[model samples]
Target: MYKYDNYDQQMVDARVSEFRDQVARRIAGTLTEDQFKPLRLKNGLYLQLHAYMLRVAIPYGTLSGAQMRLLGDIADKYDRGYGHFTTRQNIQYNWIKLADTPDILADLAKVEMHAIQTSGNCIRNISSDQFAGAAADEIVDPRPYAELLRQWSSFHPEFDYLPRKFKIAVIASETDRAAMKLHDIGIRLRHDDAGAIVADFYVGGGMGRTPMIAPLIGDGIAIDHMVTYTEAALRVYNRHGRRDNKYKARIKILVHEIGADSYRSQVEAEFAHLQTLELEPPAAELARIQAMFVPPAFDTTAPDSVDRSDPDFAVWLDNNVHAHKQPGYALVTISLKPIGGIPGDASADQIRLMADLAQKHSFDELRVTHAQNIVLPHVKKADLYALWQMLEANGLGTPNLDLITDIIACPGLDYCSLANARSIPLAQKISQRFADQGRQQDLGELKLKISGCINACGHHHAGHIGVLGVDRKGVENYQLSLGGSEGADTSLGQITGPGFSEDGIVDAIEKATEVYLVKRENGERFVDTYRRVGMAPFKEAIYG
Candidate 1:
């Protein structure tokens, strides 16, 4: 992880001071809700249906154990003693009081973390693969470039206020773990024929009421010109993107309306102009940033094998453990989605425990995944059994990675003002419906996502079995979809027939999975079966 310099520290300190005053005036009744709306939003504060929610950015989903301890402290001392890890790899604290936010920001600043650009019509947090530097299959670590972009985009004068919120994601591996194509700007980092690092650009991908997979705009932009080309792309979108209606304000809609070819032409034109200005950073600075992300020291113990004597330990080893680049080590995912528990909620004590584990077992670092899980990216394989025991005792050791029980759901009506129905309870009920470990394992690699509304914060649009909540004539209703994916073979799901009530949605999911069980071929995932057979049979089973 990159450490903040004096300049970064000063900027964060200044922002905290500015927001502190603004919050004071709002409480003093000098500024009304409408007046304080943008001010608070710029600072990553939102007035939700029940209380205020504060979103803190975790850049590229990387953080130190020290930073994690600070976050745990904030959660324990401030709001509700628990924090929600979002799909964007950020953390949100609900039940926030306006007066205490400045204090919270002060504490975060002490640890080089902040809520800046976590919300508002700006270039939100830049995300990368959770396993950025640790992935065994990476072509190059994408975090150095991501950190460079973070410095370039933060409070840029030209893009301070875009037409809408913009997102950018970078991935360097063959597998698309970051869902890069589903971002406003997705950069694929790879080596060219000459083995030089290059970035392939994809523009205009997003999900909301209108969803789109960003089209490829440029093919081999040299690493040196990454920032320059990005400037060109954002300049085009900022200049021509829709501003009249919030519904059509995202760059994805602009690309869809103007056509990809025309948009590419405009970006190329802008690139031609930006190149003359020599906008890229100095080579030394880039090298310095890259050096910070170099791989950590590995112990030479190099054990020959892992102990999986216990049945539960073997299951966890199979589900939660991922291959690591270092010998005798593995990347372990601490599943926040314990069966019948909230998907991404980590209690303060659990957070502290993870920090302690990372400090002792790993190399004092951890990563947050876009799937709402935490990764100890460098755990020794020999330690798996002991780690599982600790995590199980803390309620963080559910071995349901990519299974039906590990559902991704948003705060929904429970915390979000824009939600149409409660997503948490629905997710819980559906999780319970498939609670049997053997049954979920039999289903094989199913992804279920739920969103309370069309905002898609829950990312229902990308699930294998997606459920969406809606208000039908003042009554809460849920809609089901199938075959949505957010991986290398990314595709949006198609809606299945009419909507169902809360309980009906859970039952509908059961019926649809049963159809998969009947129709699936050998070695086929639920998504594979759905894609092969299409939606007709599942729709018939659920509706009939």
Candidate 2:
């Protein structure tokens, strides 16, 4: 994790002070709702359906045990007893009082965290692979570059008020765990034939009403030129991106209007002008940032020594754990989507317990994954049982990681003001429908994501079985999509036949999955089978 220097500390302190005054004025009735809306949004505060929601940035999804403890404290003291971990790896408290926001920001600042850039039409939090440094396939860690971007984009004068919110994701590995292709700007870090680190840039990718997989802009860009290239891309978007309508304001719309080739040319022209400036950081600065991310030391002993006696724990280890770069260690996911429970909601006590477990068993670090789960990226395989026991006791141990029951759902009509229908309850019903462990295992690597509306907050566009909620004549309706994936092979899901009532949606999903199970090849995933056979088979099964 990157520790804040004096400059970072001073900026946060100033922001907190400024927000404290703003809260005072709002409470004193000097500032109306319309007047205070933009101010509060700049600080990551939203007036939700019932109360204010505060979104706190977990930069690049990295957190220390102490930071986690602070977040738990805020959840306990300020708002409800739980927090919602979002797809962007930020956490949102849905029941905050308007007056207590400054205090929450103060608490975050004490732990070197803040809600800055978590919302608004400006550049939002920069996301990287949750397993950035620890993944086995990584060529180089992407966090240093992400941190560099974070510093450059924060409160940038020219780009502060963009046409719409901008999101950027970086992936350093061959496998795309960060959903890099679904971002406004996605950077693929790779090495050239000469073994020098370089970045491949993709711009104009986004998910919303108009989902677009970005087109590749440039390749083999020297690592030192990242800032210059990124600035050039942003300049292009800022100049020509749609401003008249919020619906078409994202960079994706600009790219679609003016073809990718012309956009690339414009960016190149801008980059040519910036080439004369001192855009690259000093080599020493890069080295300094890299040093902070060096992997923790690990024991070389084999990981098989741990007892596999507990069948439940073993199932979790097999399904939820991933191979790490280090020997005898595994990257473990703590599933928040327990059957019949809300996805990505963790109580304060559970958060504290996880913080404790991270300090004791793994390195004193944790990651909030894009799939709405918590990750202990460097847990020794030997500690799996003990960690599982503690997590199970805390209600954080669910062996359904990546299973059909582990659904990714948004805070739909239940919390979000923009939602058309309720998403959490739908996720619960779907999980219950497939609650049998054996049944979910048989389904195999099925991803089910639901969004309350077309904002695509839950990334329904990328799930294997995507459910979308809509308001049909003031009644809640659900639509199903199939064969979507957000991985190395990224593809947007295609909608199935027609919309269904809320009660019929779960059956629709079950029918689709059953069709896949029957027609799938020996070892094909749901996506692979869907791609091979198209939507015809599933459509027949679901609608027949």
Candidate 3:
């Protein structure tokens, strides 16, 4: 984990002091709600349906045990007893007092974390593969590059207010675990034919009112020119992106209106201009950042095998464990989505326990995944059982990774004022319907996502089974889509026709799964089956 230097610490401390005064003004009636909206939003504060929600950034989804402990403390002391880990690799507290936000930020500053840029029109938290350094197949760790971009973008005057919010993702592997193509800008680092790392830039990708998989605008870009190329891309978008209509403001919309070829040409022109100005960070700076991310020391003699004698442990090992880059170690995903529970909500005690486990068993580091799970990235294989026992006791050991019950859902109407219908209840109902562990295992690798609206905050556009809640004449209507995937081969789902009532949607999902089971060939997952047979079967099953 990267530790903050004196400058980083000082900047955060300054922001905390500044915001404390701003918050005091708001509470004292010197600033009205309308006047304070943008000010609070820049600090990641939101006035939700029931209360204020504070979103804290976990840059590139990486945090240390101490940071995790602080988050738990914040949840217990400031807001509710639990916090919601979001799809963007951030955490949100649903019940927050306006007066406590500065104090909470002050607490975060102590641990090198903050709420800055988690919201507002500027670039949001830069996301990356949760398994960045730990994944076995990655060419290199992508976090340092993500951090470089983070430093470049934070409070940059030119980009402080764009036509719309911007998002970026970086991934080193081809697996696309962070939904790379579903971001405003996606960077994939790979080794070129010359055995040098290069970045492939995918621009104009996003999900919302209009969903798009970004096209590869530039490939084989030299790693040294990464920031320059990114600045060029953003300059082009910031210049021509729509400001007339908020609905048409995303870079995807601009890219769609103007051809991809034209967009690429514009970015190249901007890149050429930036190259002349020597805008790319010096190589020494990159090396300095990379030094902070060296792999943890491993116990080379650690056991490479697990006993797996206990049936429950065996099941968890199969479902939740991932191969690690280091031998004799594994990446364990602690599922926050227990059956019949909110998908990403973890209690303060659970959070603290996870922090303790990370400190004791892992490398004192934890990662928040885009799937709303936590990763203990460097756990020794020999210690797996003990770790599992501790997590199981804390209600964090649900072995339902990518299963039907391991849902990704948004706060929805339950908390989000912008939501038209409730997503949490629907997610709960669906999970309860598929509570049978055997049934979920048989289904296999189904990424189910639900969103209260078209905002796609829950990434419904990329799920194998997607449920989008809409307002239909003041009643809640659930629209079902099938075959969407956020993988190396990214694709948006197709709607199954007429929307259903809340209960009807759950039954419809069951029917769609039945179709998959019957039509699927050997080794076929739900999305694979849908792609093979097309949406006709699912549409018939769901609509009928």
Candidate 4:
């Protein structure tokens, strides 16, 4: 985890003080709702249908146990007794009071955390692979590069107010775990033929009303030039991106309107100009950031095998455990989505429990995943059972990683003013429908995602079986899509014929999976089967 320096501390502290004053004025009736809107948004406060929601940033999805503990404390003390982990690897607290937010922010600042850039029409939190430092296949940890971008973009005068909000993701592996192609700017860090680190830039990817997978704008860019290249891409978007309608304001829209070739040309011109200015952060600074991400020390003699004699433990190991870069260690995903429960809501006690487990067994570090789960990145294989037991006891041990039960859903009409229908209940019903572990495992690696509206907050466009909740003539309706994926071979889902009722959607999903089971080839997952046979079979099964 990267600790904040004096400058970082001072900057966040100052923001807290500034936001505190703004909040007080709003409470005092000096600033009207319209006047306070932008100010509050800048600080990551949203006035939802019921109450204010505060989104706190967890940069690159990495944090220490102490910081995790504070998030638990905030959930317990400030708002409700639980918090919702989001697809962007951030946490949202609903039911926040206007006055307590400053205090909540103050508490966050103590642990080098803040809500800055978590919202607003600016470059939001830079995301990365949750297993960045621990993934076996990545060329190098991408967090240093992500941190560099974060430092450069924070409060950047040039991009403070873009045409619309911007999102950037950095990943080092070929297996895109962070949904890189679904971001405004996605950088894949890899080694060139000459053994030098290079970045492949993908620009204009996003999911909203107009979803798109970003095209590769530039490739083989020297790692030293990452910042300049990113600046160039943003400059192009900031210059020509639409402002007349918020609907078409994202860079994805601009890239779609102007051909990718023309967008690439413009970015190239900007890159050429930026190169002349030599605007990249110094090498020493990058080295400093990299030093912070060096792998944790491992016990050389740690046993390489786990005793999976317990059938339940074996199931969890198969479903939730991932291979680690280090020998005798494994990456464990704490599933926030228990059957018949909210997808990403973790109680304060559960949060604290995860923090304690991370501290005791996983080298005091934790990661928030884009799938809305938590990761214990460096747990020893020898200690797997003990860790599993602790997690299981604490309600954090649902062994559904990519299965149907591990649904990624947003807080839809229940909490969000923009939501057309209740996503939480739908997600719960779907998970409960397929609650049997044997059934979920048989379905295999089905990434189900739901969004309340077209904003795509829950990343519905990226799921293997995606559901979008809509208001149909004042009644809640759900639409299903198939074959969407957020991996290296990124693709947006195609919608099935017509919308369904809430219960109908659940049955529709079951029908879609039935088509997969019947049509799937050997070793094929649900998405693979859908892709192989196309949407016709699934649509027929669901609609009929």
Candidate 5:
């Protein structure tokens, strides 16, 4: 995990103090709601459906045990008894009071975390592979570059008031776990034939009113020139991105209007100028940032004392865990998407227990996956039994990590001001709809994501079966999308057809799955079968 330097600590501390005064002034009526809106948003505070929601950044989805404990404390003491881990690798408290936000920011500052850039139109939290250093498939760790981008974009003057929020994701492996195509800017870190680290840049990829897969802008860009190249891309967006209609303001729209080739050429022209300015971060500075991210030492000895035969524990070990790079260790995902529970919502106690477990058994490192789950990235294989026992007691041991029951849903009408219908209850309903463990396992690897509106915060566009809620004459209606994926071969789902009533939507999903089961080849997953057969079968099965 990356530790904050003196400059980092000072900036956050100063921001916290400054925001405290701003909050006090707003409360005292010296500033109106309109006056305080941008200021509060800049600090990651948003007025939600019922109350204020505070989104705190967890840089690159990495958290120290102490940091996780602090987050648990914040959830317990401040507003609600739980927090929602989001797809952007950040956490949101949906029931925060306006008065407690500054205090919360101060507490986050204590642990070298803050809400800065978690919101606002500037580059939001720079996300990367949750399994960055520990994943066996990684070509290089992407966190150092993410951190560098974080520092550069923290309060960038030119981009502070962009047309819309900008998101950037970096993936170091050939397989894209961070959903790079879904970000405004996506960087793929790879090495050249000569074995030097370089980046492949994708720009204008986003989801919302107009979803677009980012087009490749540059290939084999030297790692040293990352910041310069990124700035060039941003500069192009800043100059030409829409400013007239808020709906058309994202870079994706610009990419569509201008065409990918022209956009790439424009970015390259800008990059040529930036390259002349000697703007590449110095080698020593890069080394200094890289030093902060060195992996923790692991115990090599595999303890032979523990039994792995416990049926319940073994199921969790097999489904909820992944292989770690180190011998005798594994990466464990604690599924927040327990059957009949809200996806990505963990109570304060569960959060604390996870912190404790991370410290005790996983070298104090934790990660939040893009699938909206928590991960202990390096747990000893031998200690799996004891870890499962602790997790079971804490209500965090759900043996459905990537199954049909493990849904990813947004805070819809229940909390989000922009939502049309409640997503949490819908997710709960869907989970309960297929609550049988045997049934869910039989269904296999079906990702169901729901969003209240077209903002696509839940990434409904990327689900194997994406459910989107809409208001049809003040009545809640749901739309279904098929064949979407957020993994290595990322693609936006195609809509099945007309929207359905809430209950109809669930039935529609079941029908779609049934269609897959009938048409699937041997060993084919839902996505694989859908891709093979296309939407004709699904459309016929559901609508016919």
Candidate 6:
């Protein structure tokens, strides 16, 4: 994991002190809510429905066990005894007090973490594959590049108040685990014909109201030029992106207004100009960042097999454990979406236990996934059973990876002031409705995502079973969509028809799954089945 140097520590500490005073002034009524809004947002504070919310950035989802333990302490002391890990590799404290935010940030500063840039119109957290260094199929660990971007974009004045929030994702896997196509900017670390790792830039990708899979803007860009290339893309968008309409303000909307070709040309022109200015970092800086992400040493003679005679362990092993590049190591995903539990919510004890597990079973490193799960990226095969025992005791051992019950949901009406309906309760109901572990395993790899609004916080547009909560009249209604994916084969789901009531949507999802099971072929997941037959069968099942 990357350690904070004197410069990094100084910057975060300074920001914490600055925000502490700003918060005090706001509380004293010296600054109006309007005046304090942007200031608070820049520091990742939001006045939610019930209380203030603070979003803390976890750079590229990488953290040491010590850092995670500090997060657990923050969750226990500053706010509620739990925190919600988000899809963008960040975490949220929903019950935060405005007065406590400064202290919370100060604690985070100690751990090389902060809430800065988690909100605001500037670049948000830079995300990468959760299995970055350990994945079997990784071309190169994308974290170093992602971390470099984090340093470059953090508080960058030029992009400080853009048209809207911007996000960037870097993925090194062939399978696109980071939902790369759903970000404002997606960088693919892939090899060219010359067999060198180069970056393929995708521009105008986003998933809010107007969902889009960004078109490729530049192919096989030199790794050294990634930062300058990104600058060019943003400059183009910043110059011509719509400011007239808030709804049409994202880079995706701008790319649509002007054709992808025109957008590409504009970006290239900007890139050419940037090159003339020699804006790209020196080779030494990239090497320094890359050195920070070097893999932990693994004993080559360690046993490669685990005892899976225990039925529960077998289930967990099959679902939660992933292949690693090293011979005797596995990537273990700690499921936060337990059956009937709030998706992504982890108790303070669970967080500390995870930290201990990472320190003991895996290396001292852990990662937060885009699906809102914790990952022990380098756990030894021999320790699987022992780790499982610890996890089961802590209620963190849910064998529901990629299954229907492993839902992704936002804190909708429960916490968010902008939400049209409650998402957590709906997600819980659906999870309970499909509580049969056997049934879920049989169904296989069904991603169900719920968003409280069209902002798509839960990435409902990318789910095989997409549920979007809407305000129909004064009552809450839920819309169902079918056949979406946030993978290598990315696609947006289509709405079946009119939405159903909160309870009705859960039943509607059941009906749609029934249709999928009846129509599916061998090795076909719900997504594949839905794609093969289109939305006709799902519409019939829901509406008939």
Instruction: For residues 397-452, write the lDDT of model 6, one tens digit per residue.
Output: 99999999989998899999989999999999999999999999989999999999
Using alpha carbons, what is the TM-score of model 1? 0.99
Q: State the lDDT of candidate 3 residue by residue for 1-544, as single tens digits.
A: 7878998889888888888999999999999989888778889999999889999999999999999999999999998799999999999999999888999999999999999888888889999999999998899999999999998987778987899899999999988899999899999999999999999999999889799999999898999999999999999999999999998999999988998999999999999999999988999988999999999999999989999999999999999999998889999999999988998999999989999999999889999999999999999999999999988888888999999999999999999988988999999999999999999999999999999998988888898999999999999999999989997879999999999999999999999999999999999999999999998878887776
Q: Score every model by TM-score.
A: 0.99, 0.98, 0.99, 0.99, 0.98, 0.99
**Model 3 lDDT vs. the true structure?**
0.93
Candidate 1 lDDT by residue in tens digits, 39-106: 78878899999889999999999999999988898899998899999999999999899899999999
Model 6 lDDT, residue 59, Cα: 88
In the predicted model 5, the residue pairs found to clash are none
Which residue ranges in model 2 land beyond 4 Å of their true spot? 302-304
The whole-model lDDT of each prediction reads 0.92, 0.90, 0.93, 0.93, 0.88, 0.91
lDDT of 2 by residue, 1-544 (tens): 7988899999999999999999999999999978888788888999999999999999899999999988888999987788989999999999999888998899899999999988988889999899888899999989988988888888888888889999999889999999998899999989899999999999889888999998898777888889899999999999999999999999999998998999999999999998889876777877888888888877777564568888998888888889888878889999998889999999999898989988987789999998999999999888888899988887888899888988888999999999999999999999899999999899889999999999999899999999999999999999999988997888999999889998899898989988888889999999999999999988998899
Over 4 Å off, model 5: 303-307
How far is 189's C-alpha from truth in model 6 (Å)?
Answer: 1.1
Off by over 4 Å in 4: none
Task: State which candidate, 2 or 3, has the greater lDDT.
Answer: 3
lDDT, candidate 5, at 375: 91
Least accurate stretch of 10 residues (summed lDDT) in model 3? 535-544
Per-residue CA lDDT of candidate 5, range 205-250, in tens? 8888677888887888988899999999898999999999989999
User: Which pairs clash in model 3?
Assistant: none
All predictions: root-mean-square deviation over Cα? 1.0, 1.2, 1.0, 1.0, 1.4, 1.0
Q: Give the Å shift of residue 32 in candidate 5.
A: 2.9
Backbone clashes for every candidate come to 0, 0, 0, 0, 0, 0
